[model samples]
Target: MTVAEGVRPEVDARSLSDADVLAIRADFPILADEGLVYLDTGATSQKPRAVLDAERQYLEHENAAVHRGAHRLAAEATERFEDARATVAGFIGADEDEVCWTGNATGALNTIAYAIGNASAGRGGREADRFRLGPGDEIVTTELEHHANLIPWQELAARTGATLRFVPIDDSGALRMAEAARIIGPATRIVAFSHVSNVLGGVLPVDELVALARDAGALTVLDACQSVPHLPFDVRALGVDFAAFSGHKMLGPTGIGALYGRRELLNALPPFLHGGSMITTVTMERAEYLPAPQRFEAGTQPVAQAVGLAAAVRYLEGIGMARVAAHEAQLGARLAKGIAAIDGVRLLGPAPGEPRIGLASFVVEGVHAHDVGQFLDDRGIAVRVGHHCTQPLHRRLGITASTRASAGVYTTRQEIDLLLDGVRDAVGFFGVRA
Candidate 1:
């Protein structure tokens, strides 16, 4: 795990070696194909056999309704389900009661927004008053946000008569902190933003934003969808009131995700959905709900998926997160340098030699992003195109869409070279000149 003599300063001192990466690739069955070069981990990761086996094994042997039946199967299912919650909670450095399972990151974020909206509408009793928002109240976010992070707040603002403000990013897609101080004032009720730019692949200044929110007495919500999988993440360390992340992006199942909140805050917040499993006592006239995490989870839980996600975290823990971050850092540097050297290619987010994760987005002059994506696809190289769920960021960058190449733990340096070569070939194939 020692740092090489000439390694980039942005890269962590401890990184996985070439042999480590090659060995890791064997865990993913999809990577065994000779022609396939996957660089779309930003969208969804390729699951290892362990994750797949965990889910399948659960479905085969322990399939039962969690928190419902009185049989042995139900007991087993509930035990595994809650154990998965504990695993996820430990992974994020949160109390077990603090983590709430949701459909995905989008659902997790919407749960918060909707809960606040419900609180504003006089739900959850007097304890929920703290979450209430009105006309004068402001919810601050950033210009560079995925639709999942941006739209829910927009809906919350619209429903509650609260104003939504955003901190603008500079021309290079960096957050403008000077402007942020002005925007996040006493009237700001919630300060929601991404921990890392999904489009830019650059980490955001979370500590500074949290400080601003703390000074303003505002609740901080983090979109940890991009950061949690790539970086060594801890909700307690980040000092965010709440955070949301998806399992699919972290090498687990698609339908499950988590929302981490402080225990008191979650208890105070109103529930987003009402159903059988989340309640304590129910009469014909009135019904009471459980506290915190259980209050948030309703109906059928994702039992097998939870087991799978737990396995995914365990797999990641086996390979230290610091080493994972360092590996991605090296890949990011290579992407930046190679893309920068290419004629007519504009690298988004951090420039070459700057700090970023193992992902890069760019625009090629005289070529549509879709064309570039298709060109890469033709060469059996997978990448992402379009605004990448960040239309506002794309508009700010003065483009409709761009191409993105991302990596995961199973990705190798050789695959990164393949993508670079494909992009270069695409520029020539599209008749774009220096």
Candidate 2:
């Protein structure tokens, strides 16, 4: 296992009070609200002034269709769009050609899943054979998957006659690797899972899981929506077949996200979305598709959103991912520890101090998660309270729903404390405790 260097040995995600954090928070104008404890970054992060300004500048000055026209506005817009691609590509450790655009992480994931199904049906051009699915093939994921990762596979399995299987979750709400080893054997054609669990807060043991899937000759897909913005992600180093993540969840504008596939693999995979920009030529008889990323990015694309996302990438780079991750780790550990101390509270992930991201999902005994969230909301403490789109994980964890608090660069310890305090009051107010 490759443990990242410079990970502070002691600090939890909330422990960073350094000048660097102060400066980092200052760049995000929304952080000026000292009273509002925003702990919903896992759902969507708050935007920084730089990203907002970049989007505004593009709309006010260089708005035009990209990759289609030869006019002055098109030239400038094309330059900015491609430059934005370069910026995002560098941020995630991928070549520009390996990254494809989508509306959101859900869209990126569904695009890949649907494309694979299309390929299975002999619809994905020359690359169709590589991803062909049938009754003999098994597609594997985990019980911890968010519905975005889970449902698409389910639908694809139904479409292609492939058997859909999943790695089981233990009592602690984690993918049981032992069960995974048994499920992803020779018949397995693809193994997809989250890099970080949205409900569990556990970082999946990727290298070990990847090794098993690779040995079985299966392609590997990763959902990086929960990991990339919160931590440093290197797609090449991670050695996955494909990956997907959203822009808005990381403080970028909504309606844009990215999908990354290895260059060779992408070249061999059929284009998922088809339209004007995705094709080289078309006739009444047949259409020849473009290659790799361009083949995947259909239509005019989300130019301003891409620009905003690039600015968000630059903003994150300026603060440094290592620092951002360190800060989150500290907060996560502290949040886990503090929550554990309260009676009748059950955490829905790895235990305290286990490797985790800056996200946590837990339930207050007898208090419906929605009620807990509403109680917290009364104090201006915004948090996501529900099944968290992982009904399968909740079912495995023996619960129906959970309240989650996911942190980000702008999140603070004092703010987390407010959440903790709110949870205590919520338990009493909801009569979850006697």
The TM-score measured for candidate 2 stands at 0.95
Name the regions of candidate 2 deviating beyond 4 angstroms. Answer: 1-15
lDDT of 2 by residue, 301-400 (tens): 9999999999888877765677788889888987898888788888778788788888888889987888888888879898998888988888877889
lDDT of 2: 0.85
In candidate 1 the C-alpha lDDT for residue 61 amounts to 97
Q: TM-score, each model?
A: 0.97, 0.95
Residue 138: error of model 2 in Å? 0.5
lDDT of every predicted structure (CA atoms)? 0.92, 0.85
Model 1 reaches what TM-score against the true structure? 0.97
Number of clashing pairs per prediction, in order: 0, 10
